[model samples]
Target: MVTLRSHTREKARRSTWAFLPPEIRRMILEEISRQRRWSCASTVCKEWHAIVATKNLNRLELNGASAEGLSKIILQRHLVRQIYLNIELPAYTCPQCRGFASSSEHGKLAKDALRKLSKALAAWEPTHHITLELNAYSPNDTDHCFKNHLYGFKHENDGDLLEKQEAWDDQRHGWVKGKQVRLPTTGAIQQLFSTVISGVQGERPQKVPAVKGVVIRRQMRRKIDRLALPKLLKQFPNLESINYEPWRVLFHQPDLLDSSCERCDQMLQDGLPKWPKHVRSVTIFEDFNEQIMEAIRSGIDPTISSTSMQIENGRRTRYGLGEAFAVKSRHLEHLSVSFMIDARDFFTSCKTLSDWPRLRSLVLTTPLMTKGPQHRMSDFLVKAGQVAQKMQRLKSLVIWHCSHDEASAVIFLKNKRSRRNVHGSATLTWRGTRDFDFSEEVVETWQQVVCTCNSHRGYVGQCDSHQLLCRIERVEGEIISHGDAIHHLRLPDGVIDPTSLRQIRQEGILQREARAVEAEPVDGSGEDP
Candidate 1:
């Protein structure tokens, strides 16, 4: 089997790589890893495959991946550091995705798949940062557009085939309804965790496998089951960190409780459940309803109030929560609230931030530039700056979902810098919304090309058009601004246009330069001598 010439040929083939120094080989490997060329590199040789699999394949995202397929991947790459498991209902199926069909097929499938995944993970435990994201949107029916002609369809296990349900708000205006599907329960998700712990116990024999961190994004369908949440924490007593995202569901049903409805006997008897003190971070995205608006406007407690949790304005209410929302989680280091909590209320009610001594990262998001008045937004930002100054341990203050207001961003940056002392321990970033309305001034300043419609008509007046406006300050404000584009185009990062943003910045720079030139002395540099 080993002739001298044949062996020499094999050695020559391998020697190409072996001839290079180990450091040079490592540099080549790093370059491939940086480029995410794992699959290509693995095809080179067995030794290369091993090295690539061990180092480069660190983050695994399993969405609709089969249990057997997942097990093989995990077994091969035991060094995976993070896993994002996204198990969603098939855009259009029940028995197809799940194995059997029933009244509660979706729920059953979720529970079963989760159990199998947990078992697989337990069989081969890797130090992983796990994030579980489950989307509740139904695949078959996503047409939010309302067609007045299409109506009168019977409900079934599958959502109605009709495009939209119609509503006559008064006499003239017609409203189209969005998807009104019920939210899946956390009961199944909680059970999945128990299965994981049990499997870990079986494997370890004496001790359970240690979970590094878990982020759960669970959407509530009906009411948040008070008993289910407490049970989750009770089961996993060792979990030191958890980032929980809770959403109050939206659906249209006769028996469903709206904000206007009286609290049923069951809800009153069940009362509110106290969240565990150990939960390090919590996010609540409330439905935009009259109750929620009132809560933001007049400071009403959302839990006790009968508010229909319906989403509106392409955004949800974030600050319309009850007093007991996260009072127990004193150790919370990271907090993100999207609610329009008043600046005054924050300064007064949120004095407890000092209590959260461990708190470092605070993200507050609100649809201010897009929905609320400019005056209110300015006040809120001012108060946020004040709060940032007081928080001793805060490392980052992220104000997300701000409108593309250069003035506001400049103000925030100025305040942030002003607050920083010798150490300059804190950093703040203003994350503008990708979608922002172009001001009439900016629109007017930009030269317009000849309208295509006018090319045939030989008409040169501003093309008449209308767009879905984000927000208007006054009721008398013009809905359709003249000479402006009808529709707004958005960039990848959510801004309407990067070029327009750059133009705005350039204009500001030019204006400053002009002012500097105007202020300069005529002959010398002396001031009006």
Candidate 2:
């Protein structure tokens, strides 16, 4: 116990980090490197720096880097697996009396960098996944509408939105009421993709071949440019799938939608390659229109497995949802349909869909239910049940009442897919209601008295004990208030937000006493209060 020299030596050994196994140390360093935090971690030692230097790099931002920069970074690195760019291409730029020219000098430089990348990749790995976040560029920045809170400019989520036109659509030509429709500028990305094809020339291939998947993010909220995607597919011969994602899920002004163009028609037709066979998993109204009521009847592949159709402030029948899913009925898998109209229009439009042989899941969000002979919950349930039975492989179905209508109830019913196989039975997960605890006795009695009542009779709600009743009182009890006050969460002023939440015990007594002043008459006893 009195051996100081031995104790000091033991303490020194424990302080050394070398005791960690080589594999374990490498793993920790690799993970940190993937997060692009290698520099911070490498300060510990030379060995860590050496190990971390070779880990897969996070996506390199192409727009921020030049060709030479990319080449140097990717020079000896075997782990550069992905890259992303919010590119504003040269061709899409306005050259003369231009509207939007926020110049991206690297339009051609970007292609060159990709070529260098393609060559580097062909030697080592086959390809890297590319995420192209596409947005229309605007050169003119002096327009105050683009900056400040003017013309809904502050409505955009981009922090630098005050300076840039990446979110340019909000600055419409006719900014108010969308009088003048602003067509999407497709030339820039079109030119970029056109130049990035594989092996067009000698040692230097014109197209960048380093690609496995292309994630296309449409920064502008407009009817999808069907022509733009087909051209992209041709640019990368080896691209397994061309996918689409909105940079932001925007709620578009219904009046501002432009599905066709008088000027871009010839341009759209001029450069489309033969449509290749690929799954059309794009959203309905957001991605396609016109002949695309089936959504791009001629341009995109007919086969589809998953799709989302959200018709805000509109109906599906007008949107021509006819033959949209039906054409690819057998191949359908996942579906999401939300609209403002009654559920009947949606189902009626999709009534042609008697079979969804491979359908796996469905989500239907609406304010109104189907109108049938009796038009009760039973009709809705029966229709839904019938739809469910057709989907032999269906896993989950969600029915949500978005509660956007006046006095409308809110409900979120998620069904357990496994229970569908049971004879005439389905399992639904019911979220809590304000009346849930109070309604138990009523539900139990109703179920016991008429035990013969089944799901088919629309007794599903009471049986499951989750029938929403919030609307019963709201019809006349409601009065309009400030939007923020009603929509946002509120806390009493004197209540400390970050304070200890153990138990206030004394909070709300004052409010209760005030409420008691106007409370119901009560007997002098505890009975019949």
Candidate 3:
């Protein structure tokens, strides 16, 4: 009686593929890495498994695999170029609480799993990329941030107003609705990756394990105990890039030095740098405070409007993100920052863009842009122009402003042309998306602007001095009325009133009729008499 495993193995041994050379077998397995359909191929026999294990796999997704199993795989294989640790947890009865559990517990569980994973990674050679996607739980269902107010539970006797208040409370704290939760300490995260680096260093003191990039797909709602960034970067001395989701602001406390303050202090001291100069790219995420949120909703201060490109203290001093980051990584080439409330200050602080000589591409985005006052957009354009003035290497500038104004939106385009005409020619592009409900006249003007630029057909020199390429698109839901390119402008229909167009057309016809009467020759009989 032959079992299935045995039967498969015997058949694989007798197959024509079994006679292929070792190099050909390795090549076939390598192709499997590209296709990502290795399950069927690996089941052929032990020989096929041996071949698949050794080739360099660019990316390995451990969906629900155990750390021990992953460790075994790492031990058998060479370096895995990238690793995605995908873990999913659902709401369930908590054995500890003996009731419904929340997402905080799941977060803690993820930390523990990563601790084990870090230890496993330290035992093997360093990997280039590691992405943590542990927070893939349903955003609508997770109740980690929710809280219950006193008398908040709906009463059978409570009126509609009270019920509505209770619902608002529920919605506010819904992400964390349960009992008090404890977030993972910075030390735990540091030890996880540092353990691997230290362990490998102790065994082979001569070799350096350079992990180039680290990405965090999960949002960090709580502040770590210490500066996890500095500690982690010290381990991977050659780290080049880091992409992580946003965390809440690290508030200033009398006893605690926030990461920003600490970095600034470190920079002032001229001590050993926290991160390597080799770092080239960083994507930073900023938090939202009540003041900034209000400004975003209502408007920004008018006093700072005059000093758009220059540095101005606006309402409050901006966070020292750009200053501190430049202090640590002087050689950075690419930087993208997403701000919740710090958009204004971040722009102000970037006036020192010349300090980072290597910087080439900068991307700035804020949810506030969609609702910001006109002054805020004006200030942003000024700051962007200042940055452009200082940075000779800057070639790309992308702004995601959700506003409706032709003059403010194309400020960069105007600035770029000015610089090109004066300075040596540079390949400069000012690109972004604007959400506007355009009036018929505005749309006509924008179309003319685009057509005027296109008619020149010159790369740069022959084109009208002030004219540059432009695109305007009308978007209805997911469908687009324009071409399918990233630069398409999205305008929904109802944003512009049709009645306004009719009034303007009627006025134009009246003006034309009066002009014709004035231009017409007087009737021969009545004019001279």
Candidate with maximal lDDT: 3
Ranked by lDDT from best down, the candidates are: 3, 1, 2
Specify the poorest-scoring 10-residue window by lDDT in model 3. 520-529
Q: Give the per-residue lDDT of model 1 (tens digit) for 1-529.
A: 5698899998898788888888888788766766644557766777677666656656665644464455566455456655655454444332222221222444444445545555555544424433333222233322211111111112321342232232222111112132212211222112111111111111211111333445443321212233343433433323445544332322222242222212321231233233344456554322222211221222323454344443222222222232333343246676554332322333444656555567665544434434445455555555554455455455444443322221112112111333334322222222232223334332221102112344356543344431111121112211111001101211112112232233233322322222212221111001110
Task: Give candidate 3's error at residue 318 in angstroms.
Answer: 3.9
* Runs in model 2 lying further than 4 Å from the true structure: 1-9, 20-56, 64-82, 89-214, 218-224, 234-322, 335-354, 364-384, 399-529
- Compute the lDDT for candidate 2: 0.34
lDDT of each: 0.35, 0.34, 0.39
TM-score of every model versus the real structure: 0.47, 0.46, 0.47
Model 3's TM-score against the true structure: 0.47
Better of 1 and 2 by lDDT: 1
lDDT of 1 at 249: 24
| lDDT (Cα, 0-100) at 212 in candidate 1 | 43
Lowest summed-lDDT stretch of 10 residues in model 2?
A: 499-508
Off by over 4 Å in 3: 1-40, 43-58, 61-65, 68-71, 74-76, 86-112, 123-210, 219-226, 247-276, 285-317, 325-330, 340-343, 366-368, 371-379, 402-529
Q: What is the lDDT of candidate 1?
A: 0.35
